[model samples]
Target: MHNFLRFFPVFASTLGVVLAVPLNVSHTTISPAPSPTCTEATTTALPPEQDCFYVPPNGWETKEPGAVLRHRFAPQQPFATDTVNYPAWNILYRTTDSNGDPTYAVTTAFAPKDISTPHAMVSFQFNYNSADVNESPSYGIYHDIKPKLWISKYLQHGWFVNLPDFEGPLAAFGAGHMAGYATLDSVRATLKMSQIIGMPRGADQGVRYAMYGYSGGAFATGWAAELQPTYAPDLHFEAAGLGGLFPNGTATLEKLSKLQMSNWAWSSNLRSVMIGLGTMHKKIREVITSSLGKPEWDWNTVIRRLPQEKEVSRLDLKNAVNTAINSPLVRNVLDYDTTLGSHGIPTMPLMFHRADTDQLSAPEDTQELKNVYCNSGASVFLHVHPNTWDDPHFREGLQACLSEDIQTFLATAFARRLYPGCGTDNRPWGDHQYGPIGAR
Candidate 1:
């Protein structure tokens, strides 16, 4: 809305060229209706077999609620799953990196119970994975344990779900933003697989789509929404829901480095900063000195090995890890200001939720986004939770705030009706914003 970037329709074909991802397509026979083919411009061919739309085979015995198969989003490197009832499959797939290195992703098809209903698809990306850099260790474990708690609420009402391991195969730091590309592609893959599975293709032709995520997953979902209109015009999206959002990577990194007094958070913050630095800055290690440093390892090493550690506290944060992020050079490189609205914000309805108690992510992160969006003549409804405090931590509170409402909101948004629901701190903050109790 701030006109941060020019709006350009990104047909799937154009994105394939820009990303250099070759496309392929194929067919399978397990579906209830004929699947759809790529109607949008696309350079990549659909995979040769509809099974390319993976569904995990063994662990999840297919159910009659019309559950299609999906491999556990993440199990290990070089992971895979198989197709089930729908000709489409679900999988944690792999593709070549820019350097031809294999990268893994969690990809799957849209499976609806009552195959006859015109079900829309939604992808709910899970938050950061402290364990693996490329794999969504968090999503993998959560999905395995709770198949679709959040999404099931939607599928029960006639919606398909396509969750992706956006961290690529490496689960690297800034991979959060890149997860958007993976989500869009996986969505594209879903659209194709739905067609291959022989599900009612036209049932969802121009069907409404919505994306929602919190924390790390929020980063991916925001990016995907930002990229969708231009990157995959053929795949229509109705709206996007982003909660506990981080608009400027650099800003969050700076705040974390200066707040080292906080124990549990500082290490993870440093870890994220290291990942961001690894992704964006090249002169990091050279700017860091070995002595008088709080970082655990030289800048280069931390970036390379983040995924190997199961926990951050055990990773020796007293060393170079802390110093690296607070390093003037690293901060200088990250100081560049930016916002989600800098790119074209989503074209459809937008819902952004932030917590007042969130010290890890400054309130200004979402505030600046609202300013950019509203100023751009875009209509966005901002929701802030006063119960969310600055110092106490807001992740758990945020999850409790909307796990169920998000599903309901998606259903209503797709239905083009006002969403009826209740949440803590639902009162408005000002003209259109919500929250800022102490600030008020």
Candidate 2:
């Protein structure tokens, strides 16, 4: 592990030189229509409700998964600070649901205008962690500072960043399979639309790919890695970086339900999970709503209206936590979606960054995940951060993006260098005095 870390600076410099020279591939530029179909001329900004772009065209189901159904120049976001004015597009593409039924999803693709040829691509999944369609990345990314900062690093590297609304139109937050399908299919759509995004035609096959996510986003990234071998065998990811992972949704929910009694914030987390699961599975919804009694009739009403209102008060969330925790059917649905190892092991190298004191996701769960992947002969690197005074979950996620180790991992993968074998680094960041604890 130490040897690999020592080689990163040299690899990174070589990668920069390689990326500077555009690929010697044929190019064909396609002009975007001045006025895209299904767009309202009067409205400058179209939310999902009024945006016909979110809806699939007729016969969309006949198209193969990841096929781009419709695309248009994305409306200018107030918070979008692209000084170079990179070409950005809102793409509607074919994808599948958690049940393997044909469906469509939207992805926001940002391309570096200076790059004439395809380079590496990063399919970044956001942790909106909500059941509200309005809060999806396609609509909310520009407004949020954290995501913008996280995405800028990749864009600055001249890599195409594909941000998919992985929760789908329904915003089924906890449905890992659905998120996986949306994520992988988003990559396909980005590749298919390369020419339109200022890359050469047929450059999709030449592009290196990677995936990154944290917290709820990691839930999708982990599933995408696990499902890639079978679901999207044609695509290959050089590396995947997951931080603050929710390894088991069932355990997370059960833990949240028990803790919510004392903490108001935990109740909010429980409500979000319950609403997200209810949106995906009808049986779970029935069980949750059925558990609500006359005393909590208002709580039931609030849950029913959450999709539209997209807000819940602390009091309302507190009233509903018990209703979901006690439902067997809800637990059954979560149990089915929670376990990551039930699916096949990932073929790509994986980097996991976790904090020992993460409040939302238990550190033990991440250890178990690493053990499962290592036992199955998958390459894994686990970096453990020491406990902190502040929220370790949020801090660890931030540290992941800013860490030198993460940059080295991505650089090593993109350069096609030999990745370190399965190992664990328990030393805190900047503690270079000690070598990695567990190297195999």
Best by TM-score: 2
Compose the digit string of candidate 2's lDDT tens values, residues 191-275.
8888888754453547788998888888899999999999999998988988778788767766666666665545544666666
Candidate 2 TM-score, C-alpha based: 0.81
Q: What C-alpha lDDT do the candidate models reach, one value each?
A: 0.49, 0.69
lDDT of 1 at 3: 23
Regions more than 4 Å wrong, model 1: 1-88, 91-104, 115-118, 131-139, 142-148, 196-199, 203-206, 258-260, 276-339, 388-403, 418-425, 428-440
The predictions' CA RMSDs to the true structure, in order, are 14.8, 9.7
Give per-model TM-scores.
Answer: 0.63, 0.81
RMSD after Cα superposition, model 2: 9.7
Q: Which stretches of candidate 2 lie over 4 Å from their true place?
A: 1-43, 77-80, 113-118, 200-205, 258-266, 294-327, 418-420, 430-440
